[model samples]
Target: MVREPSDRSSGPEEQEGVGEQDGFQRLWTPHRMAYIKGENKPSGPGRDDGCPFCEIPKGTDEDGLVIRRGTAVFAVLNLYPYNSGHLMVCPYRHVADYAELDDAEALELARFTQRALAALRKASGAHGFNVGMNLGTVAGAGIAAHLHQHVVPRWGGDTNFMPVIGRTKVLPQLLRDTRALLAESWPED
Candidate 1:
């Protein structure tokens, strides 16, 4: 089934050079410009020095993209999630190392991770998950000054050719919606 390209004059959006297109489909992700431009990245590691992990919890959960708040730790959506429901468990303290975490912070972090998985399972029907920490910048910690564990949900056939060949991730859900759903489903413990 060969579908011919429509005449460019049909609509302003279809005009040549108005937008880039692939033969099959398009994934326009303009919001990523902020990430690419490093818009909200912190200047330093200080607790009040603009680090996102440190500052995020201070705002309303919805605005901050936070899923749940614990005594010493919190769970929040990954601003630049690899998948739609990607989440991170982080300590409230501005400590960088996992070893730096006090017993309570460490325990709560673990609990949050568990709860995040449960919430995601209930909210999104996740088949599997990739949960771990990236210790430092060299090890893939986008925000290395704060200790955080990634909780990326996975499903069968989730990894497609776009990420492998085009270096692009296709997230089907909106971040705020994903956050709201997970927050609603988060265990009350």
Candidate 2:
């Protein structure tokens, strides 16, 4: 295996690049982009988007595995889930931050979250979950353009050698099967 860089190579390699350091020199690297915005840029907009969360429908489809859809919110199966029944909730509007969500949109989001949790519980016997959002790029938002909440189901003893030793998460059920179960048991609000 290749070894990590030593102190000597790091210094000379940096200088040889014509001293061409960028403002976000330490922020992003080709190997791994730090999700966070750097000092040169503003922190976050926390605002709506022209091509943000609202664009989920353009790619998401029920037959392809969407679970539920509401007036202002929707839920879908996560292809890459932490467990068998991981899901995601997004608002029809593609805005970041809790502040921009109005009364109706906020209520819909909350209601849909509840529905997703209930369905996951019924489908996979999941009594607990880890639901959250990574607001900015630095916060681990893979798609920073659109903000959404992740509802990860958990069971006792679910953390096993697969994730730790193998560095892989294994789902017991297929994405389609999980989708069908959740779709059938979706709680109507």
Candidate 3:
């Protein structure tokens, strides 16, 4: 569960932009501005016309990018990732809707999805994972097509003033290394 910040005041004015940033200069970072704008806009990857996540990149490097690939399923790094270990397992057949998943494929996906969690945890020693799929385009889904699932690693105290105040995150690991760790540790089925 997302524990609300304890010291925060419970008043609209108090949260006009979110609590005191001792250094007003920290908010100048572009990432924070975009984050603030995103909060107001409430849009994500799907808004991009050249949606990379929708179509499987044919010639682009998938070795470090694509963490794993099965017959009908494949896992890739989320280009605009939530965290270092963020990944998405997508179906080969291009279909926007989630209800299109067949029983067998869906079942395998469930099993593999569990594997994704296990592998990420094994690789990163992540405290936990946030696994989910955004159903419709309106639901913050980036690709909208090719049903996929997200696996985001969560560590204690991932949230800090950096984002709220400084607009940054101190990611402890590189995405490439994370890919290698998860790919290597993932169980073969």
lDDT of 2 by residue, 1-189 (tens): 334333443333256434533222232233222323332122345333234344446665655467888887778776557788788887777676767788998888888888888888887888689999888788886666565789998898888876787665656677888888899999776
TM-score of each: 0.85, 0.69, 0.69
Evaluate all candidate structures by whole-model CA lDDT and list the values in order: 0.86, 0.69, 0.68
Best by TM-score: 1
Collision count for each candidate, in order: 0, 3, 1
Residue lDDT tens for model 1, 1-189 = 434575333334454567543244445678999998987777777776779898898899999999888889989999899888999998888999999998989888888898999999999999999999999889987778888899999998888888987788988888899988999999888
Question: Runs in model 2 with CA error above 4 Å?
Answer: 1-55
Which candidate, 2 or 3, has the higher lDDT? 2
lDDT of 3 by residue, 53-93 (tens): 44444534343377777767777776557777898887766
RMSD of each: 3.8, 9.7, 9.1
Candidate 1 Cα errors over 4 Å, as ranges: 1-26
Better of 1 and 2 by TM-score: 1
The runs of at least 3 residues in candidate 3 whose Cα sits more than 4 Å from the true structure, single-residue gaps closed, are: 1-64
Name the lDDT value of residue 138 in candidate 2.
88
Model 2 accuracy (lDDT, Cα): 0.69
State the lDDT at 101 in candidate 3. 85
Candidate ranking under lDDT, highest first, comes to: 1, 2, 3
